[model samples]
Target: MGVVNVTPDSFSDGGRWFEPEAAVEHGLRLLAEGADLLDVGGESTRPGAHRVSPDEERRRVLPVVADLVAAGAVVSVDTTRAAVAAEAVEAGAHVVNDVSGGLADPEMYRTVARTGAVYVAMHWRGPSDVMDGLARYDDVVAQVRDELAARVAEALGAGVAPEQLVLDPGLGFAKQGADNWPLLAHLDALTGLGRPVLVGASRKRFLGHLLADRDGVPAPPEGRDRATAAVSALAAAAGAWCVRVHDVPGSADAVRVAAAWRAARDVTTHGETSGAHHA
Candidate 1:
């Protein structure tokens, strides 16, 4: 998956694609660079970011979603608003990537259920502005897995089919820098919940901090692409279903390497089993 932030403050390439035409062009570029799908979001969910009005979000997202889908690109609307998700689906979006799970909008699950579009429910504690305060977790991995499970249950109760659901471990949303590492390390716990896991660790602060300078200054977002690509390779090897990223080419290549490596490992394991049987 490729990211298309149609907001003016997404912490990454914000205003770069804020215009519909630019966003559509970027989406095409990402597709050409091997993005399986595009995740188009209007609101800036970065830490301390303010919320945009529902009308404003719709205005920002709908046209981009419509144009991209019309251009034969598979699109997911990265929104917490039910109205926006419904409209984007109406505009031909294939998925609803809700960072807030179902907490932000009461009607989101129903809208997804009604539309029959794929729903990606990310584990989130609160809104972006106050979420940093809610990052306390006794066991981050266990808590995240359990919380995601609860959200999955809620989505199921709201009429979303189990098979249409995907899970994301909302990296950096309410997490401290250290919190993200364990989640990435224990992705099997999330995938163990019987849903495909979508990992969105692209150019996030945690990666920047990990690759910080000797003076301890974090890397800028654009500078974090290599780290993001590394995470993409690791996550793909660890059974991730998809990795959302801003730089599609690097991650696209990384995942292909991981897939080939996995194939070789599987083949080797099968050969060993056959040798043991013949012996």
Candidate 2:
């Protein structure tokens, strides 16, 4: 999955694609660069970022989505508003990547069900502005699993097919630097819930902190792609169904390498175990 932030304030690559034409171009470029899925988000969900009205979000993404889909790209609209989602689906988005996990809007689930588009139910505690305050978890991984389980249940009850949903732990949404690492390290915990997991750890602040400079200053967003690609490789190896990223080609290569390594390891381990049993 490749990220296309069509907002002016997303933590990274904000103003770069704020224009619909530019966003569509970027989405097409990502597809050419090996992105299997293009995720276009109109709202900025970065910490302390203000909200965009539903109409504004629609204005930002609908045209881009239509243009991309018309260009033969598989597009997912990253939105929390039911209205925006409905329009996006009508405009040719194949998936609705709701970072809100059905929390922000009472109408989202029904809207999603009616559209029958793929639903990405991400783990979210609150709006971006206040989410940082809601990150108190006894065991971050376990809590994320339990909370995500509940969201899954809700989505099922709302008429979304069990298979139509994908779960995302929401790498940096409300998590601190410390919290992000544990979640990534324990990604299988989320994958164990009988659902495909989508890990979006691209160019996030946590990676910057992880790659701190000599003076302890975090690297800028663009500088975090290498670490992000590393995370993508690890997550894919851990069984993530898809990893959202800004630099699609690098992550695309990383996942391929990870898949190949896992296949080889499994073959070797199986052969060794068979030899040991025969001996």
- What tens digits encode model 1's per-residue C-alpha lDDT throughout 1-279? 999999988799858999889999999999999999999999999999999999999999999999998899999999999999999999999999999999999999999999999999999999998999999999999999999999999999999999999999999989999999999999999999999999999999999999899999999999999999999999999999999999999999999999999998877877798999999
TM-score of each: 0.97, 0.96
Among the numbered candidates, top lDDT falls to 1
True-structure Cα RMSD, model 2: 1.6
Q: List clashing residue pairs in candidate 1.
A: none
lDDT of 1 at 141: 98
lDDT string for model 2 (70-154, tens) is 9998999999999999998998989999999999898999898899999999999999999899878779999999999999999
Q: By summed lDDT, which 10 consecutive residues of candidate 1 come out lowest?
A: 264-273
Among these predictions, the greatest TM-score belongs to 1
